[model samples]
Target: MTSNDLGDFLRARRARLRPGDVGLASYGARRVAGLRREEVAVLAGMNSDYYARLEQGRERSPSPQILDSISSALRMDDEAREHLFRLAGTVPEGVRPRPRETVGSALRQLLDGYPNAPAFVLNPATDFLASNALADALFSPFESVDNLARMTFLDPAARSFFTRWERAAEAVVAALRHAAGLDAHYRNLHDLVGSLAGESEEFAALWSSHTVYGKTRDGKELLHPDVGPLSLTFQTFDVRGASGQQLVVYQAEPDSPSAQALALLGSLHATRHQGSATER
Candidate 1:
C-alpha cells in the first residue's frame, strides 16, 4: 500500500529472471542475480533510463503498450501480467466495484440446500460471511472459523487440520495477494494483511514475494477431528449481484471414503442440531 509498491514489485520480479532464462548469453562477470535493468529495458524495447525510472518510483504511470511489452519481456503469465497492469495504473476500463461483504438470503438458502456438500459465502479477504451446517461442521476444528487466512496462519490447529499445510498456506497467501492487487484501499484486507504479517513470519515472507493467484477450483485434503481424513474438491463461483462475494462449495468424489465421511459428518451435525433444539 505504499507509493513504492510498484517499484518494489518490479524489483522483486526482476530478480527472478536470469540471462539464460530469457535466452541472453552471459557476457561478463555479473554483480547481481537475474537480468540487469538495462537488459529488461532492451527486452521491453524501451530506453534503459525509462525502465529504471519506472522501477525507482520516479515514473508513476506507463502506457498500456509499454506494460504489454514489459509483460512479454518478463515472460509473465496471465495472472502476473494482469497484476503488472494494475501496478502501472493501466487497469482496463469498465472495472467493477469492489465486492460487497454481505451475503444475500437467497445465496444462504442455496448453501443450506446442499445438505451433503459444505458451502460458504466468502469475501476477497476470506471472511466467512455465511455458511451451511455441513460447512460449519467441516471447519469445527478451529476455535473460530472466521477468516480462512487467519485460521491458516494464526491458529495452532491449522497445521493439523490441513493435511498439506504448506500448500494451504501458500494458496491462502496467493489469493490474498491477488485480492490486494484488486483493491489496495480495501480497509479490511489492509488490516488483515498487517495483522498477519506482524504475527506470522511465514505470512510476511510470502507476502513479500509478490505472488498473486485467484482461486477457481482446487482439491483439498483435510484432517477432521471426528472423521480423521477427508479429500474434497471445491469450486468457487462469483456471486452475480455481489462484486467481491464468492460462493464456495466443497464436494467429495462419489462412493469414495471421503464421500462416506462427509455424509457421516453431515448426519452428526444434523443430530446435534436436533438435540440442541430439543434441549431448548
Candidate 2:
C-alpha cells in the first residue's frame, strides 16, 4: 500500500468519466482520455493548477468543501464520496468513525423476536458478529459463513445459494471495497482482500474496479437444499450503540411460499434445539 494512494485513486476515478458524462459537449478531436484536467477543474469550480496539484499529490490537504465539489463533479456515489474524504485526511461532516464492535443484549433479543425473519449482525468488514437461529438455518449450507465476502466469492456453494450469483458477488466486493478504503490501515481487512484476490479471479477483477457501496435495500433470491427456492427482501439498520455494526434482517412476503418455507425451517430449528437440550 502506498503511503499516499490518493493521487492514483483520484486519477483513476477521473479517467472513468467522459466529457459527455458530466454534461460537457463532445466536439472536435479530443486526445485526452476521459475528461481533461481543465474540464474536471471547471466542473468542480476550482482552479486547474490546484486540481492538478491534488492529482499529483503535491496538495495533500484539501478542504472538505473542495473534496465535496470534486466528488460531485465526478458523479461519485455515497461510498466513493466517503472514500474521497478519507483520502483527504478528513472525515466528512455528519459522518463519525465506527465505534467498537459489540452487539448489545437488547439487539440480540430483538433478533430473537423476529423468529420468522432471518437476521444477523455484521461488522464493517462483514464479519458475522451475531445471528439469529433463522439466519443460521438460512446460511447453514455454507461450509463457513463467518465473512460474507469470503462466502460469496470463495465458496462454491455460494453459486447455487445465491441465485443471482454475479450480482451478489459484485455487491459483496463493492461493500468490502468501501470498508477497506475507509479503514486502509486495518490489517485484517487488508489480509481479507489479499486472500480473496489471490484465491478468486472474479474477486480480483472486481477489486481493481475500485467500486464502493454499502448494502442497499434489495431483494435476494436463494436456493436452499430443503426449502428449494426462496425470495426474500432484506433491510440493513445501523446498531444504535455499535458504530460500524449493522443489523440485517431478511423477510419473506406474507403468506407466500417463501414465508411458509421459513416457518417450516424455524420449526425444524426449534425442534433440533429442544432435542439437544433434552439430551444434555
Q: Which tens-of-lDDT digit does each residue in 1-280 have in candidate 2? A: 3555677677778889998789998777778567888889999999999999998989999998999999999999888998888877796434666446677899989999988899999987788989999999899899997999899987889999999999998898888777766777666677888888889999988877677788758899999987889999999997876877889999999999999999998888788889999999
Per-residue lDDT tens digits for candidate 1, residues 1-280, read 5678888788778889998999988788888878899999999999999999999999988988998999899888898888888877776444858769888889888998999999999898999999999999999889999999999999999999999999999999988888877777778899999999999999999888887888899999999988889999999998998888989999999999999999999898889989999999
Highest TM-score: give the candidate number.
Answer: 1
TM-score of each: 0.94, 0.86
Each model's lDDT comes to 0.89, 0.85
